[model samples]
Target: MADLQVEVMGKDEGVMDDYIGKFTLSVTPGTKEVEIEGTVFKIVMGTFWIKIESTPSQDKHRLQFPYLFDGPIHYSRHYSPAVGLLTNFNDAWLYSTFIKGVPLFFRNNFQLWNRKGPASFAVRPGIQAGHRLLYARAAGNAFGIIEDTKGVVELLHTGAQDDVSGGGGPNAQRRVKPAVYTYIISAEDASFRFSETGAAFFVDFASKHALHSNCAEVVRYSGEFHPRPEGGWQNFGDFTPDDPVKWEFMIDNNSGTYAPDKMLLPEVKELFEFNFPGLVVRALDREDERLVESREACRAYALKWRGVRTDELQLHVREGEVTLCRRVSESGQQEMKRAKDNFT
Candidate 1:
């Protein structure tokens, strides 16, 4: 079992606020599958409060909806967990995927801003309204820049790459670079006024020109600012849906699942258990005598009892417990369950 702790902090009206969260992943001793669970807590008015939590079910796991903190004009966050992804539903939604064999986790602090009134940070990208205004260029080896009518914003690579290659033609072999850029802004001013303005300016510029269409990939608008006396570049945060244009920008450029080869074995097992309780019970009972046996022997017994080839079956054993899985025809599974139930 691997454990990870996540924390987020911010300041409001000179008062400090914080959130603490943790998640754990437990892997079977000899298998690549894992079970995940976690919870999150926040400090409200100087007291700790439970925000979100997850509990394992008899046959599956359920993740609780995340809560947003409302306190002293500070940052707030939302969370959601799906089949293989966990997301921080903030203005700049951060998410991570859970691949079968990979252990993943993330933690970060963001200075939140409210986009409700005139004091809020807002921008109008020119693309939606048909205007050309953004520009980009690779600068030496340190970073890049995205500039507009307002000013120049430095950008860094987030190590995330996307290929926008279209139909093959004369330029089929051309090397295409990723379009995403990390906008760097100063956070010393204690507000997102400067960063927001710069982001809006860049979006407007990128919307009008074909040469900078790649700029559309710049869905994430992050910054660097001084949080303490010893100043260093830290990611303040990214643009969220508060800005209608930025929201549409992400929807148009950054929405989709990247897991093309994700496995469906677990999902199939769930379906089988849901519809074939009797057959599943019989199968479990068949292996009850071998419950305390070794993995190799138990697996062999399960295979022989099921009379299914290895490719069609998945036998998982952990701590003297055995689970039988196989790709049975939907009708066959239903019939088996029905037959078992009627047998006595």
Candidate 2:
């Protein structure tokens, strides 16, 4: 087959990036299958690449593309640790050795990761280093970030971009600027930078997708996403007589449940645990508590068809110096009763 060439027009505008990827295929006379041999192609301005997908197809072996750096790598969208390195350009560096005979010679584009956290890997991930880290780490890539003496948060042999605020040192809140204007994710249509008022301004990720809405709420630029007025957020909703103090307690307490959903994505849990175990554990515990609370709360609104689904819960208790374990379950309105005890 002739060399494939793919011309990519960046969805953004007035920009073009090319690719030089590689792929393969082979067929025998009367059969419907073709043996395929694929390889890692390159990502450049306008070159074509190929990789043999299912050469021996149940149908004719007629699948071919001669103009793309990659084929069938569709969700080739996976990320790696090198992304963090790019985001944290704080005097940190990365290195790696090329695969034995590949000509690209340790090129700056490819992505790959093995243990030591996404460093200088072949381009299995993609071009943008930060995106790679965000994807890989969030997607639960096991060997994503490996901490060393300097803690570059690297992969293979490359280094990740250092944290912007030097990693929230000391009293953290005091050391770090309140208004973090940047966001972890990037889109051609959006750009984010921190503000001095402890508020963030940027494109709304969820809002931009489908029927979510187009309002770029002044949300907090943390790991999660939440809607707030443009400068910063100071408290949660208040339901008590003394609105101010009550609001403070709500923010300090239960806001961990629904408010922070924007930052804590499903993909970020493991990395969160690894980087900050205590906080991660606390988050997990909070989640579990919320789940239990929800289950009990549901009882108040349960339908007439709702029946008690009795179950055993092994409880570990300590009364003074004594330790006791017990098993418990739901019965009739007991679930609602338990929920009220917890919140009230």
Candidate 3:
């Protein structure tokens, strides 16, 4: 069992007082399943979901461990000073390496953890550098952060135009200016990166087809469709192939956020009308009633992976402890109980 205190801080060294809280939880050795909303068991699996909020500001921030846990999970609830809403969120995995209990190198890019080798770094629980040490740690690819003797956050390697902040000091937020963004995901492992705006090219793991998308209308570009020479996003809707096979707009929703039926599809239909003037484009989400077969096919394909389904939890602060609550099922609602409590 361990006792922990939590505090929320801003990039400018200002503490969010309202978000400060204390909680205690038991961590059994070799424990397997942890019943957060029910009875506790052994073997805890899946990602850790953490949400922090302030009462006065009313700003709520959520941090969810990545499905394929590699590095730090960063989520920004505040807007950047440069851009209002654009470039507001950044989701990327960073990696660092250690050998023989000494820091070797640190790289902020998409790289898997190097397991099974003579130089494999030690995997241990708790953080040592920060003011408030985090005792709870999980198995993952790389170390989160390491400070040099000089108390400086050192970056041995970084991608092109990679900006890292909050080095050997308190938590700092990275700054990114607003510009055209290019999202490239390999079809093989789904490893993705949001490249710098107007980046000429990128090279990643080998794949038959590379899924590419710019901050443009929802459509897949085929057969030598590149960004326009002029800055900003080029509307691919303006281009028409001489030998057209089929004209269709593809809505990709790997984020799992519901945007197809509400935002992307409607905007795509409008763009199609504006570009072709007379052509009418009807777009639908995969789960739409009209596309029952497609939805079933998608489900079948997903089932092939045998991915575990995680529950959606609601965050609540009750009596100074950070507890997770989940709504009761309809059958249990007759007793007037709304949720089940589980402390983290």
Candidate 4:
């Protein structure tokens, strides 16, 4: 469901500056005969094949299985610091074990999903079994600067002792601090410029659903902005008499099964507000209305080939042609059609 570009670079006259033609490749696992247009070339050993294997499962919310796909899922459940420190170790382990098979978190592959409801804003810790709270705290650094559970527990104890004789009324309950999420953007190269002064940056969207499509549409963003007093623009800039500019942008979800990434919202807002002055930005993850329906359609298309062995699906490419043929247990052969749904 995506297009890939293959660029050929050559060394000519000891300069290594020769530019060869570029060819496009389909995203699906298949083979296709391609022509090299230039000097005379010999075609020797022009055969290759690819196979996709997986244990079929009917769990719609299953984000990942190591035996099926070999990578960690993008989603994780997070707990508030106070609550996390107070949780019992046995209770956490039991909860993780029970929920790992229940499929609470949504699956994310190829693209991110922003569900259309209040659930998108809710955080449920230890809900994803594959990534439990203990694993995240010890391995993934989910608790921010608090590296380990011991540090969190120590902090909680210190706070409780301090609150016992603190200057609040005897009837007043001690308040537990909530976790805060901070956004940090870093550049590897120091010379790289994010934007030019006094210029409007345009956001663009390109769909991966259709092959042979090279067109990218400009994204229109709707938000407010206030001018900075010194020079450049900043979101919620510190300037008196702040007047907000309202702007809107368009989004084309050609890959119907996925939505815009929520983590990128801060970066997107920064890209626009920092580049364009007097722009006040209030950004949210835009969810598609038909996301569930589109996702189900794509999942159905992929699951149709369930129970079929990996070797059954075969691909062969020769002489400017590509063919995907399925082998049956009997003696017959059937040609499988290219995937139309934007699933894989």
Look at candidate 2 and tell me the lDDT of residue 92: 15
Off by over 4 Å in 1: 1-104, 114-172, 177-180, 183-344
**CA lDDT, every prediction?**
0.21, 0.22, 0.23, 0.25
Show pairs that collide, candidate 1: 91-240, 126-204, 133-205, 134-205, 134-206
For every candidate in turn, the CA RMSD to the true structure comes to 30.1, 25.0, 24.0, 26.6
TM-score of each: 0.15, 0.21, 0.18, 0.18
Q: Which of the two, 1 or 2, has more lDDT?
A: 2
How good is model 1 by TM-score? Answer: 0.15
lDDT of 2 at 25: 30
lDDT tens readout by residue for model 4, 175-291 = 221111111111111110111111110001111110001111111111112112122122222223211223221112232213334554555555434333333444444354433
Candidate 4 weakest lDDT stretch, 10 residues: 195-204
State the displacement of the C-alpha of residue 250, model 1, in Å, after optimal TM-score superposition.
22
Alpha-carbon deviation at 114 in model 4, angstroms: 13
lDDT by residue for model 1 (1-344), tens: 33333343342211112323333333223323222222323222232223333333332221221221111111111111210021111112111111110110101222222233122112232232111111111121111111220011101111212221121123222221112222211122121111111121222132211112221322111221111101101111222111121110110111111111113223322322332232121111112332212223323433454253453222122243211111112323565676699996
Which candidate has the top score in TM-score? 2
